[model samples]
Target: MKDTNKHQGLRNQLAKQLEEKGITDKNVLEAIKRIPRHLFLDSGFEDFAYQDKAFPIAAGQTISQPFTVAFQTQLLQVKKDDKILEIGTGSGYQTAVLVALGAKVYSVERQNELFKITSALLPKMGIRPKHLSFGDGYKGLPNYAPFDSIIVTAGAPIIPKPLMAQLKIGGRLVIPLGEGEQIMTMLIRKNETQFEKHEFGEFRFVPLLEDKN
Candidate 1:
């Protein structure tokens, strides 16, 4: 699974397309360009990897579309070595982007199969997360609380209380909210009790399941 020149070309094109789609964060776009998405995908889907579309991965989850990953990452406003808690580790693609942006990523996944696969795969790609846990995303990583920012890759019905508690006073939590059609929601923690909520347009994601696999 070597990253070829052709793969790099496709990634470059995908980055440009993302920029045109209103993803203004240069670091996010560059990170998107740097990571080889096709490597994270199964061989059958490798040809379509750079097409900016979501495709099925193992464990009943889908690798997120490139634009959607960029959108979530851009909203997080990551800085160098920002401690980011990622709710899902599907395909490890989003984690790779965050790592490429110099983030200290702490990722969680519910599916045991996906978790096992990604935990091994990320290290092979040099995208090792600070901590990779198999547990509920809603619970977050309590021991490593006070994260600089948190990004939930699945559509949560409601923002989990534990996640809010784990964020630093000024941290941001990016998540998609709702059932059938989700609305991208960003929560900026203004204080211990006050959070500023901003809603982006609707996007669909698999439900964020709690305490179940």
Candidate 2:
């Protein structure tokens, strides 16, 4: 809960490193510099929090690598108050970043453990997403459909049709597609039946699971 000057300095360095690595979005970079990443990790990993690496979190998930988060955020091209649907809430670090950039996020976490923990933790850190749900990500939150943007934080074997159907026209869906090493893919909704696809190279992520309570 304590974001010390030392932590601030580390975040500054992390932001600079991300910029050098081609993360050019100033809002995304500012979000990285402001959110206390160390707070999302276990105390033992605090020293490693700002290293541009993923570290283990609860429920057998890893907080996403910083570069991956920034890259995806940049791809979303988030605007203030944009309604975003995030497929995995993991450590809530990515959720916090989206919030920092002024998006109203509705995040779904498949793991109940992560769901409960993050639902409580985020507000404590003053990062409030619009909603947090424990459910299958493939189904998405149809009740809150037509999001301004959608981000999937896990590796998907195929793009879930429901997610595609739920996007607003001109919305962006950033997902990691594949099994072992995923291709970071972004789909921009062009019309009712068409999407513009782009891939941003490879990344490793835990599989996006389905059919769990």
Candidate 3:
């Protein structure tokens, strides 16, 4: 819970690394720099927290690498107060980033441990997302349909049909699609029936499992 000047300097250095690697979104970079990543990780890994690598977290999930988080966020082009539905609340790191960008984040986590931990931790850090629900991420919070942006933090075999349907027209969905390895994919809803899709590159992530509660 203690964020010293050294920790802040490390975060700044990590932000610079992300910038050198082609992340040009200032807001996204700032969010990366602002969040105390070490606190989201187990205290044992605090020494390596700002190394730009994912570290294992509770519930068999790994905190996403900073570059990956920044890349997905840049694709989202988040606007302040825009509603965002985040799939996979593991470690609550990404959710904090979205909150820092001023999004009304609605996050879903299938693992109850992760959900409860993140639900409790976020508020302590003054990051109060619109809602944090414990349930299936694939379902995509239908009751709050039509999010301005949807980000899938896990690797899905295929895009969840419901999530596609849940996005507002012209809204964006950034997800990783595959099994052992994933292609970073982005979808922009064009109209009632069509979507424009593109693949950014490849990255590995924990699977977006089904029906785990």
Candidate 4:
């Protein structure tokens, strides 16, 4: 399936709905409009791609709802060329949005199935992140520390300390913290030992997985 005018129109409607729901970032809205969300899902679910709801994808994960993607991205306040570390590649929909906003993204996917599929799919769609690693999200990418921002796509029981340490001073970390139902939380590194925290209500997400082997 290809991205047609109909898909674009549906995306426009979705963006409008998100704006009404309080997504005020123009860049985030535009990225929502521009990226072909349909292309990120299975062919059978392509018709539901532009809706403001999440849909099931490979590896028992769901492609995040469009509004959730926009909301998290809006909180990050992504700037062009910002070095962003994404904790879950999932369907690569969020990765595409970050790329559309001109961030050099380094994403990690614990599910090897998703990592392989998305790593290949993204380049085909011309959305190339700086790095895509199939590993535990808990450890993060220490080699590429000091990111401008970090986004955790899955819900975490607790904020991973490694992700917090990977941010540059004043960098933001947007994560959904909890088990069952998560409270969207944002942390801004203030100094060597201080981080300002803010919560943005609740959201449902697949659990952040760790490599046990």
lDDT of each: 0.94, 0.96, 0.95, 0.94
Cα lDDT over the full model 4: 0.94
Name the lDDT of candidate 2: 0.96
Score candidate 4 by TM-score against the native.
Answer: 0.98
- Candidate 4, residue 145: CA error in Å? 0.8
The sequence of per-residue lDDT tens digits that candidate 2 reaches over residues 1-213 is: 899999999999999999999999999999999999999999999999999898999989999999999999999999999999999999999999999999999999989999999999999998989999989999999999989999999999999999999999999999999999999999999999999999999999999999844
lDDT of 1 by residue, 75-192 (tens): 9999998999999988899999999999999999999999999999988887877889988888999999889999999998899999999999999999999998999999999998
* Deviating ranges (above 4 Å) for candidate 4: none
Return the lDDT, model 1, position 177. Answer: 97
Off by over 4 Å in 2: none
Give the Å error, residue 54, model 3. Answer: 0.7
Candidate 1: 10-residue stretch with minimal lDDT: 204-213
User: What TM-score would each prediction reach against the true structure?
Assistant: 0.98, 0.99, 0.98, 0.98
Best by lDDT: 2
**Across residues 88-132, which tens digit of lDDT does each residue of candidate 3 receive?**
989999999999999999999999888889899999998899999
